[model samples]
Target: MFKIKKQISKLYMASILGNLSLTGAWVAILAARGYSLVEIGIAETVFHIFSLTFEIPSGVFADVFGRKQMLVVSSIMRVIGSICMICSKNLTMVCAAIACFAVSYNFSSGSGDALAYDSLKLVGEEARYERYAANQLILYRLCNGISTLCAGFALFVGYKIAYASDVLVTCIQIGVLLSLREIRLDHTGTDRKQEVLQSVWKELRVCFVESLRFLKKAKRAVFLMICNSFVGAVDIVLLFFLQAKLPQTGMPDSALGSSLFIMEMGGILGAKLILWCKNLRYRWVFAVTSVLVLCGVLIEHTGIAVLMTLGGFVAACSDDALQVRTDAILQEMFPSEQRATLISMESFTFSVIMIALSPLAGIVFSVW
Candidate 1:
């Protein structure tokens, strides 16, 4: 059991605020809106665009303006987007809401951690990265559990209550943002703002060139990113299962939350387990995924809810472990020149596949 440390201060708390609030309502809120597979697919498409377009830019923004400032802006955008989502009942409003949310996330995505990592490096705590990273995962899982559990309760109260809960979390995110300690980049009283226009152009150019270089050189690593994406896309198929079961069970929101809760909990165990793996890049993920796919097929064929749930657990653990391992590997190998863009592209490709697969999943579950 990793005890929460005294050194793990407000910065860690502040860093995760955005993800904590955003993760909770993201899936449940979409389901509540009654958007179909196609609509959800479109929303995911926008997410990919925002994520891809902003990935490198946001990191550059951090490099330029400092990470803490960008996070505040990110939280603000998320609040606005959530409000947009709450107001709209149709797919268009949902789409618009997604667009705003994507924009917000794009601006804030990779930068927060980059800022933290740099801070750690400055302090010569680079070796502790894995431990702290694992702790963050634990906190994420615990927070995710609480948030989704709250969403489940809110569903019993009403869908509006759930939406309201999201708004409140955004408020939490805002407060967390204000409390963050600001660190100046490179110990320079001379600010990145001095070279704003030049840095902007340089950033754009470097992002493009470096992203290409990473993709070209890191073939095996890139393969893992692809697998991560495709597996994630397939994971969304379980949503159709939840959606179809909801009306019949006489409560939809709670069912959706409970379904997600299972996966999140499974992810908790899977995340910490990554540190124990000796040869994750060479063996574990491929072996785990192959076996898990068999479980997926069985879950589908038998239509046993328990088996399906277990399948989700297996999938979540395997996927989460594989992703963390892959991300750690990439971070270790890639230089700052193109790290964000390469990571973004990997995520973008996955989101694209997820977008396409959502509809196919809808078709399959509809028939089943």
Candidate 2:
């Protein structure tokens, strides 16, 4: 029982360490490096392409193997991705680095939550998963906000050092992960390499087919996933472009990080406050949050730095509020056997939306 509680704590720790990336202001860094908005958009598209491809497969691997192992793979990929970014000299090289980062994201996306949820299930504390998810969002937002606060420092030091710092932090995260015990409901104790491979393939196939069957019957889950993904994609694009747009409004270099940090606080607030809406219907919640996001978009386009930053804050807040609620609902809907794969499907939806929106948004924001 103590080990189970400690597992939850470690998951929180992992979330904090994972999001404390100094290169959180990558968009601004790229703009400073003379990359055009279109070029950056292409790079983002490359990332989602890789994400779209690997998202489900990675989740399947997590279910078949172990979530802990997949998370370790995520850290390794992050280190490699950081190294690639440090050595990158051109757009193509940047895209290569982005692809590695995408793979890193794919590996860890569903595995963490699935691990935490299943761990709780073992101790019959699964009802607490919503609170845990909310706290995870809060940690993610706060750490990411702090990282955004380092934009000035990252920009000043250049990408090489900025990404090298990330490499060092990720190495530490890997150490933390090594201490986590694998939480699997089933064990295949096969020693033969060929047999193990065959077993894995069989499990992957079963997981995928079962996930599809569940989705076919669960239409509401599908709708919730799509709606949440669309809103998230829009807010993310707005935030990404704002990293460059904020500076264009004549905001001083020193204040850039602070402004971004303020914007991210909206997410933290939203995550904390969403619990208030527990009694409200999901549709009503979605309606109100979607309107808030659109209003933020309108404010962001006003060409004023203060208003634009405020707009970002509002959008982030609303987006996260909706996200927490949506995630909790979806987690309840997903079966334990296919939890990671289904969560990956949610991420897959987001990647699809991002791929469609990123380049067009870049062009629109650049011209506007």
Candidate 3:
């Protein structure tokens, strides 16, 4: 594990806080709104729909139009969705809200990594990627816990309050982006494009072609992406499992909030701890992911909210470490220019698979 440069560490905090504020209120808000288990599943479906629909184009835009540009646009979309949530509670309103939020989310997903990577490249310190990875994980954890704590207080007052807070957070993130130097991480800027948003067929062809072209160019990168995706999928399993079992405990809100907060706290600790790790002889991520899924199974088959919470902690620790290691490996393997495209391709594929399976996974957990 390496140390993140001071500048990267500072901006990372803002990014983490912005993300946590968005995610923290979301699950609790939907649950409080009387969305049934199935309806919640459908909402998740809508989220993925937004992801699936936007992933490739957003990736291209992040590459070509500039990450900061996409990020600012994403911030505005998030603020709009938060406002929608504040004003309405009807099914149509909720669906509209999900659509808006999902677009913001999908739009911003890989762009953050793209921006961070570019910043490192421009500073001629791309070798320090592992440090950035670890710091990012820790900040994400710290913000998650804080957001949930904030959410509990907000919800005690009202869920709308929590949504409004998210709006404020996004506004702050926009300012943070403006503070950073413009980054063209890759030597050749990715933003050159000749036409309007391409047709679905054109987009599909570009995503696959660009992905495959990069794959042939960097074999080691393909391996890292495969490993990252496999490990990341296990996370989806645990997430949907929570969607099922939290409702079963009859203390759904508190259970989800407490467990999520604890789990994220573990992530904060684990990420910091990674900087202290002295060796790379361990496959810790695989170990932790296995435990997380096992805990999900046990929590579902038995009445073990305590174990579920513990599982969340274990899962978080593993994921944080896994991501740092993956970044270190991939950064070393890929040329700077293609790194963003490859990562976006991997994420787009992962989201596609998760969307197809997440609903079925939720349904199975609910029945069992």
lDDT of each: 0.60, 0.89, 0.66
TM-score of each: 0.81, 0.96, 0.83
As a TM-score, model 2 comes out at: 0.96
Residue 192 of model 1, lDDT score? 23
Candidate 1 lDDT, tens digit per residue, 1-368?
21223224555675456456433645444655565545665566666656665656665565555566777777777778778867877777777777777767766556555544544554556456665666666676667655665655654565555555567876787786666554443332221233346556775676577667767887977777787777666654553345344443454555656765676677678778887884655465767765674466456545555566667667666666666666666566655434444555666677567656656665555556
Q: Write the per-residue lDDT of candidate 3 for residues 241-301, one digit (tens) a residue.
A: 5644655676545556666677678777666666677375335654655565455456545
Output the number of the TM-score-best candidate.
Answer: 2
Among all windows of ten consecutive residues in candidate 2, which has the lowest summed lDDT? 186-195
Number of backbone-clashing residue pairs for each candidate, in the order shown: 0, 0, 2
Better of 1 and 2 by TM-score: 2
Question: Model 1's lDDT to the true fold?
Answer: 0.60
Clashes of 3: 2
Candidate 3 to truth, TM? 0.83
| Model 1 spans with C-alpha error above 4 angstroms | 1-8, 19-34, 178-199, 236-259, 279-281, 297-301
Colliding residue pairs in candidate 3: 64-190, 64-191
